[model samples]
Target: MGKGGGQVHMGNKAFSSHSPSPPRNNSGGRGLGGGGMDRWTGVIHVPLSGGGPTFRVAASLIFSPAKTLAVPRANAILFTGDRVRGSGEPAIERLSDAAYLAGLLARKLAGEANAWVVDAACFSRSLAVYRELVPSVDAVGDPRRYDPTGFPASAGVANILAHCVHEIQSTITGTTMKDSAGIQDPNASMLSSCPPRTIILGFSKGGVVVNQLVTELACLESEPTPALSTHNLLVPVSASDVLSSISEFHYVDVGLNCAGAYISDHAVIKGIINYVLHTSKNLRFILHGTPRQWSDPNRPWIGMEKDKMLNLLQDGAQKCEGRLVLSEKRYFDGKPGSLLMHFEILQVMDIS
Candidate 1:
């Protein structure tokens, strides 16, 4: 979505380096900017490897076809499962998973109206990087390790991803909000106005990244951000800007290593609750997971069945007037013989 006339800053040198140069050929394919996947427009590529030995994190942006630009109601930032390699059909299929979920949420918010659509972007990282980021987890079992001291190294990577989301949200919000201000004729503007909400959905290990991003966001929202001071800010913004921008956060079958959610920090959790109650009127966090037996219970991954998790989310809901909801729905309960576990949840998740 075009950002009206405002400037949408991607980031400083770090993100700028990964940006692909504009495509030389410009055809009358779609939108104000002619195109097939406008490298210069909706999408951005952030190279997490940074010319280092470990080429772990990679981010790609995807938006609805220009036709949907008439009514971009909701903006979604989706995180796919980890180690999604190659840009071939396989990778597209993997990314399509996030896109499908994002579309589901968009349609839900849009209601029966078929005019509105959702724009989604996905962030993916390699498992090789996990060993360095989360040293406590056992590589043998994979996605099942607990780092007693908490993941300090992950803060840097998480900050980068959070900053990316912030920039993308800012751009989409500004553009759609402005577009709704009446760029098109009366007949063209959709029945519903541009969405004031942003939805973030994460699945599998990608959910772990979302967890760290939320923790980093909570710390940023604190009065004095000492935690953020330690990490190098790829994109820096005021806390009010970040807090005000986010409308909803969804963790779909988030990875188990996320023991250090908001519950891990009392002050951070308190700050977020007060902020949400006072400023974020419609803000909410949705936690959805599958049955514990379907997930790897042997590993110390944080599951919905885990007592600590219930206590943590329940505490937040209690503090914030039930703004948080935890749900566990069997994904494959049509008298299926096998369990639908972690990955299947994304496939069967019904946003409504």
Candidate 2:
């Protein structure tokens, strides 16, 4: 991507953002949607770096900052794991493929200057039994693991195209705030031209991916080598590229009634602790939760698990020489749990 301008690319081709969203169709997953904003929607078959199974997932993108982006131009990039939805288009429409709700969140947080937003839907969807993707089901329909491997490749690029808007700008070093929920600070002098970092977030059932990714990071000594490789809509991306680019890993109101929602295995947390403390780059973990998921009677353990994960990450951060920072934000506190509050957090999570 060139500075001051970038082009929209998908599947060995680049398109102009000067036009409105393309006509919608069921079979073709590539197109644009929402208020004439440059957007792309499609299905990508993402591979697992650890070599288990490829995810047949749907993804959506909102290009900001004068359009057209390529690898290495990102100010910041956000990978979002969507919450559960009902069957049919109504529910899933807001997620990875439909690109409605996720797009809204992108517009609110990443906007046109802060970071590029890649909101992902599950490879498959059904209902409360399970809503979002990431936790691939087993032969008997039980979730197996939460792996955020090679996801950028699934978004149609060897590296994801990025664009973001913060109050004005943001970098890891500079200081800025978009809202009460988050802050931005990119060094205009030192990092204005440097490649932006990454932020990975999982909401609701989608949070499972966040849990899995942190645990997996502990297991990585180097870049992830793929056992299988395939690309169609976008360029192929290496697992290491996605992994190394990450700076902030966020678990946003994630709870799916599945094992390891906030990491059930303590050993996995310990491994992450060691990995972050020893890593060269700085890493931060942010947890944004609401009373809806935390105080549910049906799932009372939700809050406890969230706290457990937060405490473990805090412990890890404390052990490191400020190389790793752990932070948490609780929204709608004291407010009774409600579905409105559950979905509302997406638009204003305040990921500064």
TM-score of each: 0.51, 0.60
**Model 1 TM-score (2 dp):** 0.51
Q: Relative to the unseen true structure, what is the C-alpha lDDT of residue 321 in candidate 2, on a scale of 0 to 100?
A: 85
Candidate 1 off by > 4 Å: 1-44, 47-71, 84-195, 224-240, 257-267, 292-295, 304-306, 322-330, 333-341
Question: What does candidate 2's lDDT look like per residue over 1-352, in tens digits?
Answer: 1122211223112221224444233322233434554544333333322232333333344433433222222223344444345534432333333234433444544433223344442333442222233336453223576554534232222322211222112221134433311222222122123334546776675565465566556666544455323111111233444455567777777765655567756677787777776667788787888888888888877777778877777776778888888778889999998766776676568776
Q: Residue by residue across 1-352, what tens digits does model 1's lDDT show?
A: 2121222322222211222433222310111111232211323333223332221122223233332223233334455555444535542444333323333333344332211111212222344223333344344214342332343323334333343333343444433333221223233235334332335566655554445445544554444433222111211123333334455667666554444321344554565566666654555566666553234545444543344544655677676666545544445443332223455565557654
For model 2, the superposed segments whose C-alpha errors exceed 4 Å read 1-67, 71-98, 109-125, 128-136, 139-196, 222-236
What's the number of clashes in each of the models?
Answer: 3, 19
Q: Candidate 1: deviation at residue 252, Å? A: 1.2
Worst lDDT run of 10 residues, candidate 1, spans: 112-121
Candidate models: Cα lDDT each: 0.39, 0.48
